[model samples]
Each structure stands twice: as C-alpha cells, then as structure tokens.
Target chain A: MPQGQPAVVPTDGLTTRQRRNRPLLVLHTGEMKGKSTAAFGLALRGWNQGWSIGVFQFVKSAKWKVGEENAFRALGRLHEQTGEGGPVEWHKMGEGWSWSRKQGTEEDHAAAAREGWQEIARRLSAEQHGLYVLDEFTYPLHWGWIDVDEVVTALRERPGHQHVVITGRYAPQALVDAADLVVEMTKVKHPMDAGQKGQKGIEW
Target chain B: MPQGQPAVVPTDGLTTRQRRNRPLLVLHTGEMKGKSTAAFGLALRGWNQGWSIGVFQFVKSAKWKVGEENAFRALGRLHEQTGEGGPVEWHKMGEGWSWSRKQGTEEDHAAAAREGWQEIARRLSAEQHGLYVLDEFTYPLHWGWIDVDEVVTALRERPGHQHVVITGRYAPQALVDAADLVVEMTKVKHPMDAGQKGQKGIEW
Candidate 1:
C-alpha cells in the first residue's frame, strides 16, 4: 500500500434523497399551450390517488374558453371507458373589467369591478373539497379585483394532503412563494403573435 | 264492485306514456326560465333510465347569452356535483346563417351551410356518439340558416336510442311532428314584459 498513488475515499451506504413526494402542481403563463392537458393529467393522478376534487375558474367571459367545459369534453371519453369520474367539481367566476362608453346620463365606466370578492370567499370558505384547481384565478388578483393575501391564507389553511393548482400568466409572487411547487411555462412560440388567431378544438 | 272510475291505473310503476321516449326538449326564448330547469330534470330522468345521450347546440355565436350563461351556471353546480357525462354534447356552429356577409364581394352560402352540416353530421354519426341535445338549435333551421329536411332526416336516421332535444319556439311542423315529446312554455307571466329589467343570477 506504499505506492505513489493516493487512496480513494470510501462511500457510505445511501440513506434517503431519491424518495419523491407527489407534489402540488402549480402552472402559470401561456394560453393555448398544453396547460390544460397537464392539469387534466394531474386530475387523473388525483383521481388515482382517491382524492375528491374541485375546479374553479376566475375572470370569466361570454367566450367559452377552457375551464370546466374543456374538462368535461376531455374527460367525458375517459369517464365512459373507466367507470369513474376522472375530475370532480367545476366552478367558473366572472369579472367586469372593460370600458363601456357613456350613452347619455349614465356613465358606462365598466373599468372597475362591480361584484366584489363575496362569491369567491364563499367558494373558498367551502374548501373542504379536495384537489382544487383554480383556473385563470390569478388575473383578478393581478388587476386588483380580489384580495390575494386573503385567498393565499385560506389556501395555506388547506390540508397538506390536499393538492391545489393555481393557473394563470404572471401569478402573484405571494402565491408562488406559498406554493410547494411552481411551474412557469415560458412561451417558446405562439400562433396569436403572428395573427393566425385561435381555432376551435385546438384553442378552446 | 269497482267504482265508475276507469280501473285504477297501476300507479306502482312507470308506464310507457310517462317515459320520455326520444323526446325533444326545446327552449326558444333567450332566457333561463323554469323551462331550462325542467329540461335538465327530464334529461336526468332519461339518464337514470340508462339511455345513450347526445347533446348538441347550433348557435350563431360561441359567445354566451346572458340567459344561457345563467342557465348553464345554475346547471353547472348540479352538473359538477353529480353529472355522469350523459349523451349530451354542447356545440357551436360558427356564426351567422350565411357566409355572404363575411365573404365580402363574393358569397359562400352553400359552402357555409355545407361546412356547418358536415361538422354537425360528423358528430351525430352512429360511430361517434348518441342522445343529441340540440340546445337552442332550432332557430338556425327556422331562419333558413340550416336545412329543415336535413335536420329531419338526421333525427330519423339517428338510432332509436338517440333521444333528440330541440329547444326553441316556432318550431317547424316537420320538427314538431318528428319529436316524441313537445312541451310549449307559453309566456303566462314575465318580468321583462313589464318595465323591470333583468337582474343578475335570476334572469341571466
């Protein structure tokens, strides 16, 4: 053992680090991307894990954008074949965040939101439901339509076993910091930028 | 020893007459009245009876009407709680009765209708789904946006199990005659006819 070469250090038996925790998936940024697919995939994981679920969308519009409808359409085929309700509970919230010009005596200033956070509070308070997905929920907070801290506090109060997903572009830093896992999807490419516009099935 | 009353009808079980056999539920007026509720209840009954269902709507807009949005909102809660994904499918046939308006100098009337029906037919084909709920789908047919005979033939060709629901008033005689159940919700009383405008959650 007196050779010129130095002896190698001995390694101990591996303890633990490879172990994984089923994370609470938080997705943000980009539309018409594969977010819904990923979210629905997470729903499947929740279902498989025997977790009851609730899906809620914020900042609603007349346009039938992705939210509850997409889940129903996407999961309908799955439910039929599997004899299971793949996703559970669907809720969509709306906000009046546009400008309407005055007609006559009445000033049609639709910039400020009318209905405050009452309905949202009710929904959040009834938060016993598991695996909650708050879709497009960040916008209202971004635009100051709702109190973000209040919602974050409620979310933190939820059980550790319960998974929650908050989806929207530019999610509040408070929400991101509160989350156990955060996924930010940087837009690599988009059709809208080129004026191609969104088509049904593909976008909706 | 029986009384004059025609032998007491066996009230124990549902008779053929009580069952909605491939019935067509039509809601013409643009409002979420008791009619929408009744239609869902009727559909729920059919769902319990183990029928393959089809839900479709031909609309001039993908945009949600105030009344329709409300109807779906009320229904949304119930649907989330217990919907098993019946044969109903929601559809939006791209806007307008004709393409002449959008086509600019040239008109693509036949092309537009062909495009619409082709898409609709594809969904209704036996290979794909069953139980068609044509939500507010009658107006296009009535307005000559879609062909009446084509609509008639589609329903007839639809399997007996494929219960069709057409919602709207002033339904063509062909549709009226083809349907198994015809319910007309006459305007006995309405707030709109009066000076009072619609309030949120109630009217819409």
Candidate 2:
C-alpha cells in the first residue's frame, strides 16, 4: 500500500480486476530478521479475511514453543469455537515429522524435508488452503534437500485462488524468479551490535 | 537468533543478563511493505510473553478496518476474559485524534500530531507498556510536525524496560542513530509490476 502505484505495468492479456485477484507467490528472503514474522503477519491478514490458513515450519524444533505458534494455535481454536475468522493448521518438521519416524541423521532429515515438500505439493494440487505459509522453506531448497526447479514448477502451476508465501534466507534464484512479490529484509543496525543477547519472547 | 554471536561485544561493564534485559528501540523504514505488519507480529510475540502491548497508528484512517486491528482486539479481549496473553491498547490518529477538535487543515493535523507525540511521551515517562508500537510515526518527524530530537531523547531516557518500535519510510537520521535495531524493507519485486492492484486482506 505504501507504493501507491507500480513503476511499470506489463501488457498482460488479463484485465485489471483479474490481475488484482490473482493469487500471489510472495517470497521473503534476506540475511536479517522479520522474514518469517512478516509472513505470519500476512497469514494473519488472510485469516481475518475468512481464508483457511496453513503454516509449515521447516527449521525450528517442534519442541520449541514459539510465540507465533502459540498465538496461532489459540486462533485456530477460536475459529473452531466461534467461527470468527478462519481455520488454521500448523505443522512443523522438526521432531514431529508425522510422515516418518526416522530422525537423527542428515539423510533422514533430507528425506523428511522431501516428504514435507511432497505433502505441500499435494495440498497445492488439491487447493487445500487459502494461504499456505512455508516458514523457512527456502533452507531445504537452498540445501538441495528439495529440488528448486520442482518447487518452482509446482508453485507456478498451482491451481485455484490459493496464495503461497515462503520465508527464509538464501532463496534460490529460480524460486525468486518465479515469485510475484519478493522482499529482502536488510539490517541497518541490530541490538547485538551493543553486546545484547537474544532474550525470551523477542527472539522466538 | 539468526546471528548467533554479536560481531563485536561492547565493554560497557554491565553484566550479561543486564545487557540482555536492556530495552530496545527498533525502527523499520523503507519503500517496501511489511514495516508495520512485522511490528504487529512482534507485538503478538510480546503479548504471549505477558507484556502489555500498545499500538498507535499515525497514518491509517481510524475508520479503516485493518485485519491486525481486529485480530489484536480479539486477543486483547481474550486476555481480559481468560488472562491468556497480555493486555493490548490500539489507538489511531486518523480522524479519531481526540486531543484536538480541529480538522481539515495541515496546521491542525500538525498540532494533532504534536499532541499525539506528547501523549506518547507522557506514557513513556509513566512506563505504561512493555512494548510500544508507533506505527508510521516517522512521517510526522519527516513532515516536521514532531521534533526528532525530542522523540529520541524521550526514548533514550525512558525508564523501565519498555521496548519502542517505530515504522514508516524516510526515518530521520537522528532517530535511526538512536535506535538499537533498524531494518530497511527492500523490495526485489512486487505484484504491482504485473499490473495487480492492492487487494483486500493482503493490503490492509
């Protein structure tokens, strides 16, 4: 909204309303904070629009209770009880890799990451949710645990009006190329510069 | 959390815990989106930690029903009823500038902005909230409606551990210099480039 008008508009065949309604592939990638936090914020906006929200975490441990996770889980319950906003589903690949029981090995982690991506691909094919948040999902693609081309193809070809947002550092060029919106969070300064350590609530 | 260690550790003679618990002044400024949204997400995290959250919007119209406002209002009521999260207070300066009865003039708007900043300064002196979000507060400073030196002085000398976050474009150099953490939201790509206009839920 800050950018009242785009610098350039392409000569696409679609009308203005059609283009406005098009689902977005938003990517937040940089070597700074607020990438995933901003994605969760976008998910909040989507949820307020009565859209089903799905969040998939790739790096954080399942045992770790993040503040966003707690808040979103509570929101999910609120939706179930009052039907005020929309449905929310949150899944993490850390220790709670429900698809497989294997863990503690690099190969197993890669396999789990692949499985996670596969599940997302399936859900995309089915148009399962209105907004899908692949939190820190670029790590797998960057690490080659999941194929970047495959992910890009799946995203570019996904059907329905489902929106997808991916957040992490070191996003692959192909994925960035395919994304409709890309933001790089650049750190001008950090509290750590003053010898402060990460504390409770703020870091998580 | 991403930066595991600070690049340089200051020798301020403060203990690790003391430095860790020190309040922070964060500024988000850039031409891209997500500045205020990310601040709201941080507010959610702070709320989970039982920190009183206060949000003051300087730019957006009070009549506009933003999604984060609704969600946070619900969270605030939830805290009141069940004591789940901390308390939340959201205020906007659009048409709801209650400090003055004047409207429709640049001078009146400037006076209202000054009044709003004075109120925030009073709250800071009182140490009212654990986290204070001055959404789009930089605009007044940029417009010369509020003094940057006055704000920086209040924020730096404020008592207690009240974290302050300011969001907007064109942040003053003085303010950025005073802030402990500063992030610039840079846009690599935007949907508007493809002729898409801002849509409901995503933009608001």
Candidate 3:
C-alpha cells in the first residue's frame, strides 16, 4: 500500500486499465460514525469526474437536513448553472419515494423501504447514475425489511459502469460477501465516551 | 448511538447544549482508503454551518490534483461569491508553503512539513478556521519529520471552537489520546485485492 499502490497484483487476464476502470460495489459498515460521510465523500469524487451522483438516504428522517445535502444541492445547482460537474439527485426514504409519502406504522415503514429498494433497482437496470449512494441502507436489510438475496442479485447483475456505495451499521454478511470493497469504521475513541454530546456541523 | 444520541451523559457540569457545541479534534487513521475522504466530508458539514474550512495536504505531491481539492475550491469560490458558506483555504506541502517551492532532497520535504505545522500552529492560535483538515498529516509524525509531542501540545492548548481533523495511517498514540474522536478505517475488502489497479475519479 505504499504510495497508494495495490499490495498484490492478480494474474487476471484483463489489462491493467480495464481492471482499474471496473465499477465497484463499496460497502461501509460498523458501529461508528463516518459510514455515510465516507460514502458522500466518494460521491464528491464521482461528481468531479462528471459522473451522475444519486444519493438515496434510507433511514434518516425526511425533515432532518444533513450538511452534505446542502452542499450537494449547491453542487447540483452549480452543475446546472455552469455545467462544471455532473447532475445530482438526492432522495430520502419516505418523502423522496412517490409511493411512500404518508407516515404510518412499522408495516408502512417496511413497505416504504421495499418500494425504495425497488426504485433503486429500476435505476440500476436503467443505468441512471454513475455513482449511487445508498446511505443508511443497511438498516432496512438488517431489519429484514428487504431481502438481502434480491439486493445482492441486483447489484451483482447491475449493468454499465455504475458504482454503488452502501453505508450503515450491521451490514448483512451476504452484502459484505457480495461487495467488491468493504470498510468497517471502528471507533477507537469518541467525545461521547467522555460524555460530550453531538454538535452541529460535526455530527450532521 | 441510537438516533445519534450520546450513550453516556457526563456529570462534568457543562450544560447539554454547551457540551454539544464544544469543538472537536478528530483523527482518522489505519490502513484504509476513506480516511481523507471522511475528513473532507466532515469539512462539508462544517462548511454548511458557516465554519471556515482549511485543508493542508502533507504527504501528497503538489502536482497531484485530488478531486476534493477541486470540489472544495469550488466551494470556496461559492462562499466568496454568495456568502452562503464559510471561506476555504487549501495548502499543499511544497507549493502551498511560500518557503519551499523548489523540489530538493528529503530534508527539504521534511522542512516543508515542519513549516506547514508551524503555520497551522499560528492559525490555531489565531482561531483561524472552524475546521482544519490536516490531510495525510500523520505521515509527517510517523516519518519523524514533525514532532508528535508538539502537535499534541498545540492541539490541546488551542483556543476557541476551531476543530481539527488529521487523516492518515500510523497515527501516533499521543495524538490519538489527545483526540476527542478517532476512527480507524479497516479494510475488509478492496478491488486491489482482486488485482484491480486504482482508477481516476474513484481512487483520486
């Protein structure tokens, strides 16, 4: 890993450039902060490459406004106005999905999650985005709201050069197994360990 | 960590709001890729909160153009034009520092790193930026180019609500002890593990 070089170079028949350019399914999981933050950071890189950036927040409330949303919205506007970067589309679980606007019981939430995954599946099939950020998406799978097998199948069979990054705690073993890159954010120390509360800007 | 709530509420006497608003010193370290990316994403949040963002690249070459640098520069320009967010300052080791423009021996690079830390120390004393992203800064300390004790002392005694985040592998133990929050990004899987080389936009 010195100088950002890969530790092992495989004997795969593909050329170096071809192997390098392959789209990735990256997963960030663990009981720590920065899962979604890292995913959004990857989206920033994707956007700079003029890649269509689509973010789907699965668990966070629609009313809650994270800083990345504001900044990305600004980037989207920049793309529209000046065409400097790529287009950006952000969707939340309940409100962003057309079929899941009304808030309801646990069953309703499950239905919403299912519908959200369905929409993502459709987008993946259509190759709508160059990078798809499924933020906090693991909760749905962890809670058994969505079938892990179906999700993995869709991702494994996804078309085109679309890269997908999923972030949340308790990522399913199946999902981790299917991912090309998986990072576990381990909390070595935290302000909360000393009783400090979360702050604005730092913690969404 | 349920619903972003602190697990423990300390009896340290500070009000909840006061404790919550306290600035943080965060460190991201370990053998993984998302260290700098997560730091930049945190900077994005800080920016939305009108926090001045300062980025210093310590290990990367001045000739290398990272996507975060380009995106944050755009953000800095956006802040200047519309006053929507806080200002951003980006500095690299050799080129960004006025004293070390010419490429020379390893000693020169070490001197530049020292100068970079010195400038950051001055800015910390002045409470310059709301969020200081010491990108890949641990390399200097790990390589013995910069003194870890000095960095820890300066960070501990820094005044105001200026948050600092250092990202790289091999973070010193003293710095980790001084940090309010620390995350270690562990690699479960990587494309490189499968013999894939790094690609533009995704790797950079």
Candidate 4:
C-alpha cells in the first residue's frame, strides 16, 4: 500500500492543498543503516524546492566527513552564487556542541546535550529553517543525557511550517508517539555481519 | 553500536582492504517510505566518490520527475563538463524500456522489466557502473514476472566490486537471503494517517 494511508482518515474538511502544506515530523530510527542517508536525501529534496535546510549532527566525531556533507555544502555554495535552490547549513556536534569540546566528564556531556537541545529549541521557536535534520539525535535520549519528554514537547510545540526529521536508533517512545512520520530501519543482514569493514566511499 | 561488526568474522584470511573492496548487494525494503530516497542518497555518495552511477526505474512513470532525478542528472552534466566527479545514467521503465516504444499491456511491462534486468546484468558483467540502483524492482519479482533465483545467482557470482542497491517493498526471500545488506523500513506513523497528501519535492 502507499505510505501513510491508514484505514481511517482523521483529517476532516481539510482541502488536499491544505493537508499537503502542513508541516511534518519525521523520525528515522532503528539498528540498521541508511536512516541518516535517507534524511539527507529528503534535505536534498527540500533544497531543490527552495526550503532552508539545517542539519544538526549529534554523535559523529569531528574528523569524519560523510559524502552528503560535501554534496550539500557544494549545493549550498551553488545556491549562494546563483541565487538558485535553498540555503543549506550543516552543524556537527564536535564543532557546534560543547559536549565534544573537552575531555569531559559524564556530567559535562549531559550538560552539553542539554545545551544542544536548548539551541535546537531556540531555532525551532525562531522558525530558522524549513527542514531541520536532527541527525543521530536519539543517542542523547537513549543515554539519558537529554530528556525525551522535553524533546517531544519542543517538537510538538514548535511554530511555523518547519519540518523536523530525527535519525538514530532506539528512539524514545514518547517522541515516536508525537511524530507525524516514523520509519524503523530493521536489519535483516549487514556486510559487517560477514566480517567486512566500512569502506571509504560506501560507508563514509 | 557501529554497523556490521560480525561476531564470527567469516573473512578470516582476507586483508582489510580486500574485504572492504568486495562488491555489495543491498536491499531497501518494507512498508515505510525512504527506501528509494535512501537508495538515491547512496547514489549521491557514489557520485561524490567519482564512481559511475546508474539508475533503472521499474515502476514510476516517465512524467514523474523526482527531485533526486533532477539533482543527479545535473550532477552528471557537471561531471561531464568539469571531469570533477563520476557520470550518472538514469533510465525509467516508462521511458527507456520497450513499453515506451509501443502501446503496451501487462505482458509488455513484464517484457520491459525482463529487458531492464538483462541490460543491468550485461552492465554488471562489464562492470560499467560502480553503483547500480534498481528502483522499485520488487514489483516485477512479486508479480512473478522476473525470476528471483536467477537474480540471486547472478549477484552472488558477479565479477568486480560494483555495488547494487535494489529498492522496493515486498522483496523476495531469496534476494533478502543473498543480500550483503538488507534493511526493512517499518512504518510507525505517517502524515497520510492524518490525511495529508504528498507535496512536491517532499514526496515526488
């Protein structure tokens, strides 16, 4: 069946265009790969449509450079030069969040996580971007560094037509319940399961 | 945890580089959205790595222009002019296959699907592309139009390090079993549940 077509339609009297224009809260979570990749893909689509795109990476190390970062950055530059496409901004935790700033203690990390969420909340309230990607965000919630209830509340109460997509494994149930869309990447098999390691082009 | 840390380490004697260089057969399947989006993201990664990318669409109509198609095609042209990245080729069933040549029937679609697979097989044998995306490929197999066993056998025995990613729902058991990586997208909730329709760029 087509996606999101639940048997019962709860949206009564809304025109198709009205329903189409509503903002979406999307979650990509589970043990398998591609959650972040899929979010990047959606960001690309949003960028194509002239939607401001903001990517906030929560867990990755500072040195790691995924291919999407390069592609989107280039696209961002192209947008700036040509006045075509949407603006793109990418922020990694190692650079943007204090949690990765020092050889910190657990409490420090928790404080940093809280600060990160606060920053996101500020942006959400300001209506900073059309598409906001909270990449690998579940880790903070999973580790109890960031409260799931607060994240859910911020997302639920955020203003504007901004769309939020959070990607990571072990998503909190409260966030899932609040999300308009959630996809769990279930692993049936993996190359690492067969003793293969991540390669430069494919993995990064 | 990081993906694919196989417990048994089946590739005992292979060097890390050697194991990393092995071709992969990846499947993105399930009831949720993002299967195609994730595949396109991989294709984007492949393009960034200077790898030739080939996309074969089996189900979507020719007139339906997805944002990724436009992005990749533009990237492909940029590569041709600058020689900075890899080449990209996109062929849809409604355009590139036999169905486009004549007034068609279900049998014609089956024929086109078969011909499409044959072309991909030829490319696999020739190692023409570093990454091959068979978009919406499951429908033919699910409909009994294409033989799943043959596909599995070909992929298992294929030459070179060309990666293949097939995206669609209802993937065959044999294909899933033979795949190096398989991810099933489980839907928890969707915007359509609230009677929201697909928006341009977001859905196409």
DockQ by candidate, in order: 0.01, 0.73, 0.68, 0.62
Pairs that collide, model 3 = none
Candidates ranked by DockQ: 2, 3, 4, 1
Q: In every candidate, how many clashes are there?
A: 17, 0, 0, 1
Interface RMSD of each: 28.6, 1.3, 1.7, 1.7
- Cα lDDT tens digits for candidate 4, B12-84: 6888779877888999999888899889888778888999999999877776778787677767777887775
Specify the highest-lDDT model's number: 3
List candidate 2 segments past 4 Å from native.
A96-107, B98-107
Candidate 3 lDDT, tens digit per residue, A36-117? 8888888888989899999999877788889999999888888998997789998887544644576564436777899999
Candidate with the greatest DockQ versus the true structure = 2
User: What local lDDT score does residue A69 receive in model 1, on the 0 to 100 scale?
Assistant: 55
Per-residue CA lDDT of model 2 for B29-140, tens digit only, reads: 8888888888888888898998999988896666777888888887888889889989999888876464553566554567778888898999999999999999999999
Answer with 1 or 3, whichever has the higher DockQ: 3
Candidate 4 residue runs with Cα over 4 Å from true position: A1-6, A11-13, A98-108, B1-5, B11-13, B95-107
Q: In what order do the candidates fall by TM-score, top score first?
A: 2, 3, 4, 1
Instruction: Report how far off residue B41 is in candidate 4 (Å).
Output: 1.7
